[model samples]
Target: MAEIKKIGVFTSGGDAPGMNACIRAVVRTAIYMGKEVVGIQQGYQGMIDKKFVPMDARSVRNIIQMGGTVLKTARCMDFRTPEGRAFAYKNLKEEGIDALVPIGGDGTFTGAEFLSREFDIPVVCVPGTIDNDLYGSDYTLGYDTATNTVIDAIDKIRDTAASHDRLFFVEVMGRDSGCIALHAGIAGGAEAILLPEKETAIDELIEKLEQSAEKKTSSIVIIAEGDKNGGAYNVAKRVKEKFNFYDIKVTILGHLQRGGSPSSFDRVLGGRLGYAAVKSLLAGENRKMVGLRNNKVELTDLHEAIHNHTFKLEEDLLEMANILSI
Candidate 1:
């Protein structure tokens, strides 16, 4: 590959906390390496529409604490087509963007892989989704902040639930992954948790709630969005049938879990991954995802990061969560 003189950076897929921090790191790191950085306003869509901005150290000042991406993000369906990708490439070449750094989740990496292979553009990805579903990185950028946000909501809900002796079914975001739900459920002292990875029949959930109700316990059941037994509303209705306490309530955290000031862990992780991504791109690495494993920066093949998912929480942690909840 030709020498990487200028690097283009963008954030894609869902907006995540600590994204701005990552953007800042990418800009500063690239600038420090004497490479000019171009900020793509909205991922591949921005590339196609020519939404580009020159970034320097001053441009990213004081954005590390921000909740969402300063570069913004979006799902560009058009980027899936060859014509759209060719257009994006034309725009990139026109803008003098020689290498690329994209921060995002699985879909983001898949797009990166496609573009890199098609055009031979050097690309490095930083895992920046709240889902934490990607295989290579143990922790994505926003997982900590989102987990903290859910626990904060759960703690507040606990106070009201205890007062009213209410059974609260709190739904958190984790489509196709239970990382958030499992972490928050264990931390928030939830009585039961429904995860997408584990299939729990409604009857079995009712049996657990029944046991709680018999003890006059004010319970909180954490439900992941992709739970096998539908969502929080459905789980609440089914549990209300047989396990009636003083009251029953369902609270869907929804997107609330996605927006918040980036936690210290997220900010640091974002900076690390972003810095490593630029370094990787400069090292002539292409179609690679930058991640932190065992507290050190590691690079994984973008194709494997997108296609091979072995993300699993400790089974013993789930077991201990159930035991401790009781």
Candidate 2:
């Protein structure tokens, strides 16, 4: 194994809760190993453009409970290009960086894998997206926190819905996958959940609402943002037309789910994943991602994780939703 000296860490893709905790853990762990840590700003772009800052224990202090990333994050479209990758290599060589630890989603890991192969430097990926769509991992770092946030919002919205006897269409964030929507919908006690994994027919949803209206005064339908059939607003319009229900409201939980104090689950998960990432680097494992499987932290090849498709909503839960709502 190469003598551990200075290591670089960066957060990429969308910022989420527990990111600061991950950054803190990596910096503290590396320092305890008698190594200096470099904070790369704006993810891969920072490396390619030579933007970096030194990190210390004090830099991460008081940030453990904070949401969002202290190191900041960005998406660099150019990093996939040969010239950009070459620039990253040259910059790493100039800075004498021994290894890199990237905390992000699949796209970020893909870039990390490319940089590792091109530069011959070890890169460790820590799954840190709220999406929970990364392969080989039961849960991503920020997923629990995001789920709790969505549940909280739903709870508050439920109170208003009941008071006004209104039907609310709550939209949660989840682009290509429905992990967040499914988990949050179940946990939040939503009446109906529309996920990307299944096609939600507007006619069926309206029929359910019309039937439920006879027994229940209010309703809440959680819809994923990536719902191809329609969004909450469009669904609300169709529901009003089909059922003549004019009290429908749409609330898009946009970035609110991404911001909040890191829950205990997320803080602990982030700490463990961060430590595992450093351990992987120390163990001479390169271009791999740290994930939890069988209740234990494990490593997987980043390339496989990036190329594999491992996302699907639980069928039993979907069936249960259909049974209870209809």
TM-score of each: 0.98, 0.96
Per-candidate total of colliding backbone pairs: 0, 0
Where does model 1 exceed 4 Å of error?
A: none
Best by lDDT: 1
TM-score of 2: 0.96
What lDDT tens digits, residue by residue, belong to model 1 across residues 294-319? 98899999999999967787799889
Error of 2 at 296 (Å): 1.0
Steric clash pairs (candidate 1): none
* Best-performing candidate as measured by TM-score: 1
For model 2 the local lDDT of residue 263 reads 94
**Worst ten in a row by lDDT for model 1:** 237-246
In angstroms, give how far residue 90 of model 1 lies from its true place.
0.4
